[model samples]
Target: AQSVAQPEDQVNVAEGNPLTVKCTYSVSGNPYLFWYVQYPNRGLQFLLKYITGDNLVKGSYGFEAEFNKSQTSFHLKKPSALVSDSALYFCAVRDVVGYSTLTFGKGTMLLVSP
Candidate 1:
């Protein structure tokens, strides 16, 4: 079975500082990784994805992720943090060879203080 782990329950960062939300995943064969952000009472919005090609992938909202195949990690990164960026972030993975359904991590709440 495929799975994802977001070790941090929450991440705290001051506005204007860089921010990161760690994520690790496990899957058989090639993996399709994704990051999604969910605002309060809202649906998950796609942030970025790592399916193939470039190890470093960029996405919406000044966010990017580096795919480390050896470490099985896809950690999200932002050069600067904003209070408006605070939200519940989730890491998901899918097995590219078999199924298309995504397995999501519990989620990490990002708190950006001004």
Candidate 2:
């Protein structure tokens, strides 16, 4: 089984300040990690993914995540945040080896203040 957790229900940041949204996962086998963002009345948008090769993965809208294998964590980050960046962020995971279904976290709301 594969599962993900977004420990923070909400994250608050000021515009132009750095931001982070934490996520952790568990899987029976090697994991394929992903991050997605959903805006108000919109669908999920792919932020980034970690299949293999790199520990640091970059994504759309200046977002990035670090894959920590030992800790089983993938925390999303941005050097500077924007008011438009305020949205619901999700962490997802799937087992790399089998017919594992993708699982997502409840979601973390990112609120950026100007």
Candidate 3:
């Protein structure tokens, strides 16, 4: 079984300030991590993924995530946040092997103020 957790319910950031959204995971085996963003009345949009190789995975819209095996964490980061970047962020995980299903976190709301 695999699961993901987003500790913060909401993340508030200024228009140009750097932002981070924390995520942690637990799985029986190796994990495939992913991040998605959702806008109001819109579907989830793919942000980035961390499967293998680099620990730092870059994604769309200047967003990136750092995969830390030792810490079992995959935190999302952006150098400069925009007001348009405000949305619901989700973290998901699935086992690399076997019949594991993708599990998503409760989601963290990012509020960027102009």
- What ranges in model 3 sit over 4 Å off? none
What tens-digit string does per-residue lDDT give for candidate 3 at 11-102?
Answer: 99999999999999999888999999999999999999999999999999999999999999999999999999999999999998888777
Q: Estimate each model's TM-score.
A: 0.97, 0.98, 0.98
Q: Rate the local accuracy (lDDT) of all candidates.
A: 0.96, 0.96, 0.97
Clashing pairs in 1: none
* C-alpha lDDT of residue 34 in model 2: 93
Error of 3 at 44 (Å): 0.4
lDDT of 2 by residue, 33-106 (tens): 99999999999999999999989999998999999999999999999999999999999999998687789999
User: Please, what's the RMSD in Å of model 2?
Assistant: 0.6
Question: Residue 48 of candidate 1: its Cα lDDT?
Answer: 96
Give the local distance difference test score of model 1: 0.96
The TM-score between candidate 1 and the true structure equals: 0.97
